[model samples]
Every structure is written in structure tokens, then in C-alpha cells.
Target: MNPINYLYLSALLFTIGGAGVLFRRNAIIVFMCVELMLNACNLAFVTFARLHGNLDGQIFAFFTMVVAAAEVVVGLAIIVTFFRSRHSASVDDASLMKL
Candidate 1:
């Protein structure tokens, strides 16, 4: 398959993720969309690394994955805590957290 195909797929995934983050009402769905966007970025990084014949992009992707993993841990914990206190996981309801 052409490398360009990977880039196109990455772009599509990123776009979908962005739209989900923008339009989704559920907090969990938005979180998943953010993860999807991160994965799309990893894909693009790998593709660029392959095309350039260097490890820089791959290394950057590795670090990104590490950070993303940490984010998942913290983000899920917060989500669960919020869910336990609030009955719903709707993004609109998150505004109540300000209090």
C-alpha cells in the first residue's frame, strides 16, 4: 500500500475524533475521541519516520504513547470519580464541577 494511504487514513481518523470532541454529549465518548486523535498522530509520526528513514518520528511517537498512557490513567480516574458523584456523564453536566 502507498504511504499516502496511511496519511489519508490518519487525517480521516483525526477529523472524526475532532468532530466527536466538538459534538459529542457524553464525556466518555469525548475521551475516547481524544484517544483516537492521539493514535492518529502516532500513525502519522510512524509514516513520516518511515518515509524519512529515521527514528526520530518513532521515538517521538513512543514518548507520545507514554504520555497518553499516563493521561488515560488520570483521565479515567477523574471520569469515574465524577460519574460516582454525578448521575450522568454528559459533558454539559461537567460545568457543575466548577462548584
Candidate 2:
């Protein structure tokens, strides 16, 4: 397996995630897409780490995963609150930030 293949896979995953974020109205789906993007990045990180014979990329991926976990916790809380108030998790309906 070539390292470039991993990069190609990562690119595909990122493209799909980006498209989902742009086109999906459901907050949960959008969130999952964002996670997909993050995992794609993680895959790239590990691939590069293996290629370079160093731990730096793996360390970065670990930190990224930690941050992503925290994001999931906070994002879900906000989404749940929005759903409770509006009875839906559509991104279009979350106008709480509007001035």
C-alpha cells in the first residue's frame, strides 16, 4: 500500500465531508460529516507519521482527537437544547446567533 493512496483516500473523505456540510440541513448529519473530515485528517497524520518514522504526526493526531471529543460534547449539548426548543435539529432553524 502506497502512502499516496492514503492521501487520496483522505482527500476523498474530506471532499465528501465538505459537501455534506454545505448541503445537509440536519445538524447531526453535519456534525457527523465534520467528524468524518477529522478522521480523514487523522488518517493522513498516521500515514505521514509512518512515512517519516517519527511520532510527531501521531502526537498531533492525538491532540486533534481530544479536541474533537470536546467539540462533540459541546456541540451535542447545543444541538439538544435547540431541538428541545424547536423540535427539530435542522441547521437552518438554529438562528440563536443572529443579531
Model 1 clashing residue pairs (backbone): none
Best of the candidates, TM-score: 2
Q: Write the per-residue lDDT of candidate 2 for residues 56-94, one digit (tens) a residue.
A: 999999999999999999999999998999999998987
Cα lDDT, all candidates: 0.94, 0.95
TM-score computed on alpha carbons, candidate 2: 0.93
Off by over 4 Å in 2: 96-99
Per-residue CA lDDT of model 1 for 27-78, tens digit only, reads 8899999999999999999999999999999999999999999999999889
Error of 1 at 21 (Å): 0.9
Candidate 2 residue pairs in clash (backbone atoms < 3 Å): none
In model 1, the worst 10-residue window by lDDT is: 90-99
